[model samples]
Target: MSGLGQSGVTAVKWSAVSTLARFVLQLVAQIILARTLGPEIFGIFAIGMVVLTFATFFSGFGFSWSLLQRPTLCDEDVRFAWTWQLVVGLITMLGVYLLAPALSAYFREPRAQSVIEWLSIACLLSAAAAPSTYLLQRDLNFRAGGLIQVGSYMAGYVTVGVPMAILGWGATSLVAAWLVQAAVALVASYVVKPHAVRPLFWYADAASAVGTGRAVFLTNIVNWMLNNLDRVMIGRLLNAQALGLYNVAYNLAAMPNNLLLGALQPAFLAAGARLQGELDRLGRAYFQMLATIFVLVFPVFVFLALESNDLVHLLYGSKWSDAGSVLCILFLIMPAYVIWGLSTPVLWNTGRKYYESVLQLPILAIGALGFYFFAHQGLQAAATVAALVLVLRAVVVGTTAFRALKLSWIELLPDVGRGMILSALCAISVKAGQAAVSDYEMPLLSLAASTLTALGVLTLLLVIRPQILGVQSATMVIRFFPGMAQLLSRANPSTQRGPITNPVSEQRL
Candidate 1:
C-alpha cells in the first residue's frame, strides 16, 4: 500500500477502536451522572462545556492545522507553533476567567461562573498537548494518537466524571472531567514523546503560520458557534431542566455524524494535502471517500429519524417528550454534513483556507441567525432551523467543492447520485414501516426495528441495483472485500463470473 493508503487503513482501524471505547465510557458516565444529578445539573454542565469548547479554538491558535498541512515543517516551525500556543492558551485562560461572570449572568446561574473559571485551566493543559498530537497526525502516527485519546478518556472517566457522579458533585464533576482529560493528555504527551526543540521567543516563523492558522481558527470559531449556539441559547433562554433534555437529544441525534466524521477528518486532510495538484485523481478519491462515508453514515441517520421518539423516551425518559422533535429534525443534518465534511479537507488542504472560511462564514451565519430567530419558541423550531441550515451548508459546500475540482454539479452528482437515492428510499421505507409497528413505542425495539428495516432496504438496493453502490459485479465485491473471497466462491454458478481474469485477458475474452 501507498503511505497514504496504509495511513488511512491504520487510522481507520485505531480510530474505530478508540471511538468505540470512548463512546462506551462516555455513555456510561452520562447515564450515571444523569441518574445521580438529574436534569438541572446536567444542563449547567452541558452549557458550560459548550462555551469552553468554543473558546478552545482560540487556544490552539491554528497551529495544529498549519503543522498538518505544511509539506516540510522544521524544528523551528514546531517550536514557534508550540510557544504561540502557550501564549494563546494563557491569554485565553485569563479571558475565560474574566468572562465567566458575564456568562453566568447571561445564563442566570451563579454556579456556572465557578465552573467556567475551573474549566479555563484546561486551555493551558490542552495547549501543552496540541503539539504532540499534531506531530503524531502529521507523521500519520495513528497508534500514538489512538493511545493518547483512549488514555485520556479512561482517565477522565475513572478519576473525575465517574467519581464526581458518585459523589454528586453536579456541574463540578463535569468541569473536573474536562480537567482530567486534558491533564492526562498533557502528561502522556510529555512522557511518551518528549520534544527536544527549544522554544522560540520570537514570532517570525510563527508569524508566517499565523495567517493560515488565524483563518482556520476563525473558521473553527464560526463553526463552533453555529453548532453550539443553540445549546447556549437554550441554557439561558429555557430552564436548566429543559436544556438538559434538549442537550441529550441533540447529542444522540448528532453522535453518528460526529464520531464517523471525526475519524475520517484527519486522514482525509492528510491524504488531500498530498494529492493537491492531481485534480482528476483528487476528484475521484474525494467522490469514492464520500461514497464510503455515506455507505456508513446514511443508514444511522435514517434509523435515528425513524425512531427518534422511542429513542428519546427510552434513553432519557418520558419526562423528555419535548426532545423528540429536535432529535428527528437534527437527524437531517447528519447525511448532509457527511457530504460537506468530505469537501472541507480538499478546500483547506489545497491552501484555500481563506476561501473555505469565506464559504463557511455565510452558512454559519445563516444557521446561527436561523437558530436565534426561532430558538425562543422551543426545541422543534430550533431543530428545524438547524436542519435547514445544515442542508443549505451542504449545498454551498458541494458547489464550492465541485468548482475547485474543475467539475460541475452534474458531473459530481452522478458519482454519489445513486447512494443518496438508495439512502432516501431506505429511510422512507423504514419510516413507513416504523409507523406501522407498535414495537417502535419501546426505545430498544423501535431502534432495533428501524435499524433492521433500513439495513434490509439498503441490502436489497445493493443486491438489486448493485451498480448504484459501485459494486456491480462479483469481482468488484471480491476486490473490496478480499476477506470474503472464500465465502463468495460458494455462490451458485449462474450468479458468479467463471474466473477472475487479468484486465488484458478479460478484454480479449
Candidate 2:
C-alpha cells in the first residue's frame, strides 16, 4: 500500500479502465443521440446542462471534496456532509424547477424549460451520492469505485438512453439517461461504501470540513464560469442551432481531456498528499505525469484537429458539417486545458487551495468579457475566445503551482520540447499518410492511415530515444508491460545523461 491504501499505478489502472469504459458508453450514446435528434434538441439540453452543472458547483458546497483534503476526518463529518448535501440537492432541484421558465427565456430557448425541469432530478441524485463517493476516493479505492461508476453508466446509457433514442424519444432520451445515470450512481456509491446516513443536527461537528469546503466551493463556482461561460454566451447570443453545433464541438474536444484527467487526478491527489513533505519526490512524480500525458494525448488532439472535418462527417453525419471548424478550433486548445486541469490536484494537495481559487477569478472574468465581445461575430469567434482562455488559464495556474511547489519549469522543458517536436513530426506524417490513402478515395481508410502513420512515427521515435520523453515518464508507463522496459533499454544506446536523457535514473521509479 503506497498512500490511501493503494499504489498510484494500481489506482490509475482501475480509474483508466473505468474512465475508458464510460467514454465508450458516452461516445456510443452521443453517436446515437446526435444522429436521431435535431440540433435544436441538443441546443435545448445543452442550455439545461449549463444550469444543472452550475448548481452542481455549489450543491454540496464542496464538502465532499473537503473529505479528501482535510488533515483529519471523522464519521461525524461524513454524516454532516451527506445530510447537508441532500438538503441542498433537494433545494437546488426545486429552485431549478421554478426558475426553468426564466432561464429558458434568458437563453432564448423556449423548449429548454421542460428540459431544465426534467434534468433537475439529477441534482438531488448527484448530491445524495457525493459523500459516499468522496469517501471511496479519499481511501483511493479506485477498484470498487471504477466498477460502480462504469456499471452505472452502462445501465443508464446502454439500457435506458440508447434504446429510447432508437425509439425516437428525442431530447427526452438524453434527460432520461441523465437521470438514470445519476440515480444509479447514487445507489451504487452508497452501497459500495455505506457511510453514516443518519441525518445531522449539530453543524459544529463539521468545523474541519467547512473551512476547506468553503474555499473549494467558491473556486468551483469560478471554475464553472470559466468552463461554461462560452456555452452560456453562445446560446444566448446565437440561435439554438448554432449553440447546438458549438456544444457538440466543445464536448467532443473536451472528452479526451476529461477522460485523461478523470482517471489520473485521484491518484495524483492521494499520492501527492502522502508525499507532500518530500518535495523532491513530489516534483519528480508531477513532472513525470505531465510529460507522460503530453506525449500520449497531445498528439491525439493534434490529429483530431487536423482531421476535424472528416471526423465530424464520419461520426456525426453530414448534418454536423458546420461543427467541424468549431471542433478544429476547440481541439487546438486541449493540451493547454489538460495542463491546467493537472495543476489542480498539485495545488490542492499542497494546501494552496486558496491561491488556486484566486487564480480562476480573473480567468473567468477575461473569458466572460471576451466571449461577450466576440460571440456576436459567430461561433468561430466564440471558440477562438474560449481557446485563448484555456491557454491563458494554463499559463496562469501552471505558473502559480510551480511557485508554490518550489519547482523549476526549466527542468521539464527538455521533455516538453521533445513532445512538441514529435507532435510536429507526426503532423507531417499525417499529411503524408493522408495523401498516400487519398488515392483510394475512402475517407475511413484515409483516416486510419493518417492515425497509424502518426502513431507509428511517434512510437519509433520514442523507441530510439525514450529518454527524450523523460525516462521517468516513459518508465512510469511501460512499467505496466512485462519485458517492455528491457526492450526499450536495448533499443536505445546507453548514455551518461543529465536528467532528461538518463536511462539509469529511470530505474528509480
Best by TM-score: 2
- After the best TM-score superposition of candidate 1, give how far the Cα of residue 106 lies from its true spot, in angstroms: 1.6
Clashes of 1: 0
- How do the residues 352-389 of candidate 2 rate in per-residue lDDT, one tens digit apiece? 88877787788888888899889999988999999999
Taken over the whole model, the C-alpha lDDT of each candidate is 0.71, 0.80
Q: Tens-digit lDDT track for model 1 on 1-509?
A: 12235445566556656666666666666666666777778788776787688778889878756888787877777788788888898898899989999988888888778888898898888887888887777766666777788789778876678787787677887778879888998888767666645778666566668877888887887778767877877777777777887787777766677676666677667766776776665665566565555554565676677677877677667666777887888886778877777778777755577776677677777777776778888878877877787777777876777778776656445545655776687778777666666643566765677677777777776555554544222333343455654444433244455432123212100
For candidate 2, give the lDDT of residue 476: 56
* Candidates' RMSD to native: 4.5, 3.0
Q: Candidate 1, which segments miss by more than 4 Å at Cα?
A: 1-4, 294-296, 414-417, 428-441, 460-465, 471-481, 484-509
Candidate 2 lDDT = 0.80
Error of 2 at 398 (Å): 1.0
Runs off by more than 4 Å, candidate 2: 1-6, 203-205, 439-441, 490-509
Q: Which of the numbered candidates is closest to the native, going by highest lDDT?
A: 2
